[model samples]
Target: LFLGLIILIAVWKLSQTFTIMNLGKETSESLGISYSLLEKLALFLVALTTSVTMITVGALPFLGVIVPNLVRKRYGDNLSQTKLMVALVGANLVLACDILSRVLIRPYELSVSLLLGIIGSLVFILLLWRGGQKDAV
Candidate 1:
């Protein structure tokens, strides 16, 4: 828990840097951001967080992939603004799936990964469909 908090704080602090980095390497560098260093830092943080999460709660499958995309689709591409919403939505999704898995079969519980996988696949398909429609238009 403490480690997670530390990582969350680190990520929160760097959110603006990340936003600048998203503007492309040359642009961010022109704006006084070290693109390579920030990229390495971001990758390191992601690796550490993923390692910790896996050790703590097993694998969450597509929660990472889907939550941010969903949040971005609704809230645009600003990392600092969307970060909290992503965390909240991801937590709520896992909590809801876990609760449903436990209650859906009475005595027998489904694996949270299984539930997330099914839901994630559907959401991914929907996102793809929406992307295709936008491209077509």
Candidate 2:
């Protein structure tokens, strides 16, 4: 649950970063948005969201990482655009994986996290391949 919560928060952060970056630091700063204030707002929101989600859903899968990446890739990485794209893609990915897992092990069930981990590994590999050079890990 904690892990899922973290990922949810991360997704929110990524979305915010992509949006805020385009707005430019200058504009944001000029608006009297202090770094500490923004940071606190973001942190509080993510935490509240994840905590509520965790209690209700026992942690949804693939929402944090997959949605944002899929959005960034398909749509322009603008704040509003990316957020929408990520939400849609994330939902689709989770649904598809859930279906696949059900079919793959008929009577048995698989954890969404486990399936996402496998998919995450593949995604990581693809990212590395597409990246011209590796950064310090």
The candidate that wins on lDDT is 1
Evaluated at residue 69, the lDDT of candidate 2 is 59
Best-performing candidate as measured by TM-score: 1
RMSD in angstroms between candidate 2 and the native structure over all alpha carbons: 5.6
| RMSD list, candidates in order | 1.9, 5.6
Model 2: runs farther than 4 Å from truth?
1-18, 21-24, 60-62, 132-137
Per-residue error (Å), model 2, residue 50: 2.1
Q: Score candidate 2 by TM-score against the native.
A: 0.70
Tens-place lDDT per residue, model 2, 30-98, is 655565566676777678777877776666654675556556655756765566566677778778878
Per-candidate TM-score against the hidden true structure: 0.94, 0.70
